[model samples]
Target: MMPKFTHIENDRAKMVDISGKGEVVREATAAGKIFLRPETLKAIREGTVMKGNVLATARVAATLAVKNTASIIPMCHPIPISSISVDFTDCEGYIEAVVVVKMTGRTGVEMEALTGVSVALLTVWDMVKSAEKDAAGQYPVTAITDIRVVEKKKGK
Candidate 1:
């Protein structure tokens, strides 16, 4: 048996329709972690990263990503996002980016939240790539992982 896909109909790919659903307040929170070398983490902590304030830059990137997620993801519906929040947590040898997206619409904002977290983590990596690179100019110790929607809520 073939698995069903919400974006597929009659052997054609299509965007899912939420038009018949009533408008509701929807929110989603997503999180991802970027692992870095000890030195890279220290540089971010000391505000000495070459690019600039890493978290602030990431936050802006996340906000934009949330708003533009529909463009990047073909099946995602264009949603009216009411609020977006981005936050970062500094931990041992890693940093975590969390994004929360809220909107009153027929569809949920999980894709937007996931996109925000992904872009935020990527921005963090870009900001610190110089410090994270080895003599061979490779990022052997840098990685982004665990991108997921940690929370989703909807209310009438």
Candidate 2:
């Protein structure tokens, strides 16, 4: 049998009830990469993206995005977030953003983590788009890819 949709009832969308569920320590990590041109990458590395520090700006955006995930995603509960961390890794022609979120609540924080990574990567794109855009005014080399939750853990 197919699984039932958690947010649908009586053919309408609705929020899940988690009031009865016991609060537990929840953690989740997500990651994604954004491909950029070599010149753009060098500019990012040299802290000369013009939009200011790419990683630092993205980190702040990720943190804020994680905290506001519930507000943005319908059906998500407004749970208290205990901690959040954003990290980055540079590859051959791309940059990876990893976001981790922790909470002691009735529900997990997987969505929040994923949202953080996505927003962070998008922030990177915005920061470097000017440098990567071609004469056609398009971002041919700028792309956000492989966004996924890498880890999740509950209460100890």
Which tens-of-lDDT digit does each residue in 25-80 have in candidate 2? Answer: 99999999999999998998999889899999999999999999989999888889
Best by TM-score: 2
Q: What's the lDDT for residue 11 in model 1?
A: 75
Which lDDT values do the candidates have, in the order given?
A: 0.93, 0.93
Q: What lDDT does model 2 reach? A: 0.93
Looking at model 1, which ten-residue stretch has the lowest summed lDDT? 4-13
Instruction: Mark the regions of model 1 whose C-alpha exceeds 4 Å error after superposition.
Output: 1-11
Give candidate 2 regions above 4 Å deviation: 1-10
Report clash pairs, candidate 1: none
Candidate 2, residue 123: how far the Cα is off, in Å: 0.7
Q: What is the lDDT of candidate 1?
A: 0.93
